[model samples]
Target: MPHKRAKRSIRDAETAKKGHNLAPQASTYDDTPRSASRIFNAHAVQSAFRKAGRITSEDTGERKPKPSSSTNTSSSSSSSKLKPQNGSSSSTTPTTKQTDPKKPAIPSILPNESLGEYNRRVEEFLRPGVSKAIKEAASIKAAEEAAFRREKKDRKKRTRIERLVKLGKMPQAALDELDKEMKNKAGKRKRGDEDEGSGSDDNDDDGDKTTTKPREREEKSFKPIEAPRRLNDIVQAPPSLPHLRKLGQEKKVGKGVYGAVGKGSGKDPLNAGQRRILEEERERVVKMYRDMKAAREEAKVEEKGAKVKVKV
Candidate 1:
């Protein structure tokens, strides 16, 4: 049992040592050999750094570094080794670098031959179809403009016709004739008057005498017609109503009525019989109005002028 226990203790110590060597350790400020080894190993543990380099190479494929002859040789060898399994290879050859011209030449104001050729090509590409479209559009626009002008002219003509119609003038068909006649008559009359004024003495005297004879004849033929007198003028005075006077009263009469002293006399406007008849007539008028109202209510009649239709 002692021997077995001693062996087991030796095995545990060896296992612990291996674990200590393999496990990651926290870093601290120390330069001990063990710590130094730990730091070195930590840096060295980036074994996949080659993958990052390859990824960079893949991303920037075939880009040549500055080609010193020495570098060229080394890169050629390295590139050959790193050649892709897909049979693709990166170039190690140096590219010829173009130096920018010392002064950039000023562009010509006029197009160069190449620019002219390019322009011609573009124009040739668009010419047939674009020109046809443009012409068709212009033609349509012209037609529309012409139609608009025609419509405008027609509208003006219609307005002129309407104006003439309203003024009770000749219709459009006769307007030109009427205008021409009026112009001709005005011209003729003006010329005739001018001739009459500027004619030789004998002709002017004859013209004046002829015009004066017509004036004399017109005055001689004129006769005034008598106008009938108005009824108001003929009467001259307003008619008077019958006088009413009260008993024992003397009253001066006016145009309308007299005092109550004349009442019931033969000369009174209303004698006793006439006064009774007037009272009966007043009652009849009142009864008639009442009967008319009752008849309207019985017939369920509304007032005649109440309802009216309104236009919206």
Candidate 2:
């Protein structure tokens, strides 16, 4: 609705008012307007073209210094400094030195490197330490396995000693000695014996010999285990009760006087149910005797196997 110049003046007034509230300018601030240069230079477009390699012509979109007779000597000296000593026409750009062709290409971190390059170098440096740590862990695992085996063997030995002591075959002193040895070695046995006991064994031989004499006496003093007495082979005869025998005999006859009321002054005769219960009880006693006999046979076999003949 407003005229162009009136609108422009109004906008300018508003901007000037807003500018007063702005933060302080940066140190790189430039007062000159860039409107003309932005259109004519077109730096963004030139950079894009350069990156795409589309700027094929000699025109680099940059202004080159003009050659003048007054600066000829300075330009010649600068150009001379840029040239190689070999006097080749090629530009003296730096090239990385070639390495051995046969060697594998190893990634390395150079000055100002980042990302994959830095990571590669760090990994290479840590490789040996990582491998060594893995090997050490494996060795520790092996040591643990060996220690577990030794502990299992020691447990079996302890159990055997305990059994012998319970059976009166071994004295309590041997068990106490084993316990003492276990306590002494508890802390130092994890990494396995390192030949420290070899010298101690030689030095303590006399003491060991003296101790062995008492152990031998204890072994000799132990009484032999006497075999348990065999059960009495005499079979006792059944009771001579007339009423029970009569009832049992009557049971053999089918439809006999089993459930009928008895006509006697003495205790009433056992009924069919009572006779049946008595028969079951008798059978149970016979089964128990058979089981006992089998158990005795098994014990005899075990005792034969357990007998050890000392070659004196």
The top-ranked prediction according to TM-score is: 2
lDDT of each: 0.64, 0.70
Please provide, for model 2 over 1-312, each residue's C-alpha lDDT reduced to its tens digit, 9 standing for 90 to 100: 445355778879989988867787677866557987677678887898889976432554332233435567779566533222343333233233336775434445566877787788768866887899999899889989987898898899999999999999999999999988887777666334545557567667777566554444543567889999879857689758655454445443333465343443333677789999999999999999999999999999877777743322
Runs in model 2 lying further than 4 Å from the true structure: 1-117, 187-312
Candidate 1 global CA lDDT score: 0.64
**Best lDDT goes to which candidate?**
2
- Clash counts per candidate, in order, are 9, 0
Q: Single out the weakest 10-residue window by summed lDDT for candidate 2.
A: 82-91
TM-score of 2: 0.26
RMSD of each: 33.6, 31.3
Regions more than 4 Å wrong, model 1: 1-51, 56-116, 170-312
Clashing pairs in 1: 244-259, 245-259, 245-260, 245-261, 245-262, 246-260, 246-261, 246-262, 247-261
The residue-by-residue lDDT of candidate 1 on 1-312, one tens digit each, is 665555778889988887755667687776669977877787555556555554445654533333345466767666554333343233333232324575333233233458777667656755777898999899879968976786577567667766887788947666566556656866886698678657766676698567654445444665788898786756668999897788999555544454433544436565799899999999999999999999988665444333332321
Clashing pairs in 2: none
